[model samples]
Target: MPSNVPTFTDLLAGAKRSAVHLEMRDTYYSNPRFESWRQGHCVDWNDRASWWRPFHQEIADAVARGVTVRRARVVSEPVTEYIRWEHYVTHANVTAGEQVRWLPRRLASDLLLPGNDFWVFDDTSVEIHHFSGDGDSIEDEILSDPKLIELCASGFERIWERAIPHEQYEIH
Candidate 1:
């Protein structure tokens, strides 16, 4: 996280039409929440107060503003332990108004995807996330080049079309 680069909340708040995310990695080493889940911490879905957080509130707020927030994940199957943990907690994302989908890597073999994960905002700008080989997030680069934005935005839509909605997708 850098001072110059806008945070997710900032980007979402500024988004007018749509905010889409594409995640291709099966693991993220920097996430403490995943660590908690690995240690046996489970989200009590019945109790909203237990798992709800500011991030969800951001998505809810953005959706309330008519922003179509969607996330599509391209995972390898038999999924990694981290992907299983991600699946366990995806309800929060759905509850927050994000339309989530999953596409197995095997099913995406024919598609040309982006080299990095990204968030395309309003089809005008893109936030490309960079990660280390060990799955630790390194930095994010925001680009507004028309060609690059178009490429990423279109790439996301292609994956979205092939991905199964979270409600229907069963972890393998």
Candidate 2:
């Protein structure tokens, strides 16, 4: 697959099963569309300053609607800002019981934590090509060539195997 080619959506829809590979980059929620998606039942790999409120809202909404949300973090600068806002503006709904897989940073640690949900691979450094609808060529491109998805899924599994279970995480 060409690096410049777009295949994410087709890969997602074509996926009989899917694993999401994500990274926590800065400025993720600024996009309106991304915000709308965040409003739905989704999992994120985020270590941003402004992510918690929306994240909390999304988690609460998902839980209310009977959806499971999981998260993972690997030591980005501590979310001091998010913590302050969370403490002052909203009551914390994410309790210690909620499972969040934590991993070390040699590999893609963030991607490993959230399993079975849509992988929001935050490769913000690279230009992400998005595909829409059932374009025959695009479907053929991803289905016939499963390398992209396989590589992503394998990466997630590898890190997942080595990660610490979020059950042990202390809520502060």
Candidate 3:
């Protein structure tokens, strides 16, 4: 694996058409924000300053430049506590002009999902992320292979089609 892989911002920064992210984890091991939420620290969306982060602003800026950003999360039906908390913070994503959707794992049973989560940029390249059993991000691989890109993009489209929009999805 090459150590010069592009970060999410790196990929998005060069995206001219679209950016789609696919997330398939129920819980992540090394996410500080998730840990904070797990420990009862919720983002007060009402407070404008509290929820504004550099990453969110980056998404907003991308949208402003007409780059369509979309995210799809395939989660368990009986949502995990972490998923529930994630749902609450999704407001920031929407505010950043990124489209988000949630699909229950049951609904994805027939789908050919990827083994790892990924972000596809303009259907040209993919940032495939590897996670440990405990959900720690182990590594991210960037690929420009046609077959891999096709699989990831098509998989994301399938999930997005069956997922409920953020505004309509209710946590379990």
- Cα lDDT of model 1 by residue, 1-172, tens digit: 6688787778999999899999999988747788888899888899999899999999999999999999999999999999999998999999999999999999999988889999999998899999999898888888889999999998999999999999999999
- lDDT, each prediction: 0.93, 0.38, 0.91
Residue-level lDDT of model 3, residues 1-172, one tens digit each, is 5547677788888889899999999987747787787788878778979879999988998899899999999999799877887899889999999999999999999999988899999999999989899887888888999999999999999999999999999888
Whichever of 1 and 3 has more TM-score, that candidate is 1
Those runs of model 1 whose alpha carbons end farther than 4 Å from true positions after fitting are 1-4
Best by TM-score: 1
- For all predictions, the C-alpha RMSD in Å is 1.3, 11.9, 1.7
Highest-scoring model, lDDT: 1
For lDDT, candidate 1 versus 3, the one ahead is 1
Q: What are the clashing pairs of model 3?
A: none
Per-residue lDDT for 104-154 in model 2, tens only?
Answer: 454453453332222432312111223333211222232222444455446
TM-score of structure candidate 2: 0.35
After TM-score superposition, the amount by which residue 132's alpha carbon in candidate 3 deviates from its true location, in angstroms, is: 0.4
Name the 10 consecutive residues with the lowest summed lDDT in model 1: 1-10
Candidate 3 least-lDDT 10 residues: 1-10
